[model samples]
Target: MTTDPLSATFAALADPTRRAMLARLAEGEATVNELAEPFSISLQAISRHVKVLEQAGLITRSRDAQRRPCTLRLAPLDDAVDWLEEHRQVLEGRLDRLEVHLRTIQQKNQEHDQ
Candidate 1:
């Protein structure tokens, strides 16, 4: 387990099965068997994937009588998304500056052609 929440979230998302599980959970909470039904893997495998998601803080499992329903946890995901958006804004700003510089060069070229 990484000390960084973002890194842990990314790591958890890196697995396709886990990503699919998250998507399924997004619709609503599901039992382990429900989450495992879409894939050919064993229930144990799904349980392992669920454990990783739980560790990453992406999902929470609560007991409802005999069922342990897994619900999606949005806080870590929101934080990850916020982090990505921050970097995206920084890149967009750089691209905006580049666009301005290119426009200036184009204007200079037009003047020279004239």
Candidate 2:
């Protein structure tokens, strides 16, 4: 299926296995077998998860002898972070306006109570 790069990235990251794989890769690179070690699932499962990450461009796999070692690329993740941060700033601005409004209302209530 076709998706925007950011959507593809977030979708790829939606799985816990993929997230774990990414976490493992963050320590550097490892073959599929090494990445599969921490989990109870089969190596095939881990390979599929790695494929998702590869499709998302979050990881890169290079051929080292007979093994394809997956390495963390991370460049695509910046788009996801940037998207979240943009919305966060907008939400914070709305919250700041609400705080000011509440403060004004509280001050008026205090003044009228006198």
Candidate 3:
């Protein structure tokens, strides 16, 4: 259930469970059983989440005997953050202009009333 890195990232983030898994992984690596312990769901569900994260390149799984430890791979998120930052900057600039415009109108209205 994957298309590309961007699509995979967006798809993985579409589910709350996967996001939580990433949050937990941010602290450190964990096995499937360890990740499953925090949620009320089963380990299978956590496995699915880990798979999605892995596909998104937001996480990785390594074999350690019988345990497959999940680790956060946050490098991919840097691109996402940069994208968001650019959009945010544009919106903030627009808002600043709107504020200035509103202030100009307000000042003119005050002068007219006086």
Candidate 4:
């Protein structure tokens, strides 16, 4: 079944290897071989990770001569950040209201004791 862009992005990012590959691409474009260099996994594995990133719209691959270099795409990351920031604001608001209620209850208890 097809997934939403945010779901697909999160799924791809759930893998540490794919996240690292994205980090590398952030620095600059890189071939699968270059991405594989730092890891002990085979080139095939790195290529698979690259494919996941590409499918998630997190990266793009282009052919330059015989090399296929992958470049990072920031749109998906920006989407994720926007979603997180929205939810963080909601949670913070909820916490602020709860804190106020607790303080009011504490003051009531103190008055009753006095």
Q: Single out the weakest 10-residue window by summed lDDT for candidate 2.
A: 42-51
lDDT of 4 by residue, 41-99 (tens): 88888778888898999999899999988899999999999999999999999999999
**Model 3, C-alpha of 80: deviation from truth (Å):** 1.5
Better candidate by lDDT, 3 or 4: 4
Q: lDDT per residue, candidate 1, 1-114, as tens digits?
A: 346889999999999999999999999999999999999999899999999999989999999999889999999999999999999999999999999999999999999999
Order candidates by lDDT, high to low: 1, 4, 2, 3
Q: Which candidate number has the best TM-score?
A: 4
lDDT of each: 0.95, 0.91, 0.84, 0.92
Considering only N, C-alpha and C atoms within 3 Å, which residue pairs clash in candidate 1?
none
Candidate 2, 1-114: lDDT as tens digits: 788899989999999989988998899999989999999998788878888899999999899789888899878988899999999999999999999999999999999998
Candidate 3 off by > 4 Å: 1-4
Q: Give candidate 3's error at residue 110 in angstroms.
A: 1.5
Give the worst 10-residue stretch by lDDT in candidate 3: 1-10
TM-score of each: 0.87, 0.88, 0.84, 0.93
Deviation from native of the Cα of residue 12 in model 2, angstroms: 1.8
Residue 41 lDDT, candidate 2, scale 0-100: 93
TM-score, cand. 1: 0.87
For candidate 3, report its TM-score. 0.84
Q: After superposing candidate 2, which stretches have Cα over 4 Å from the reference? A: none
Candidate 1 vs candidate 2, lDDT winner: 1
Top candidate, metric lDDT = 1
Q: Give the candidates in order of TM-score, highest first.
A: 4, 2, 1, 3
At residue 107, give the lDDT of candidate 2.
98
Q: Which regions of candidate 4 fall more than 4 Å away from where they truly are?
A: none
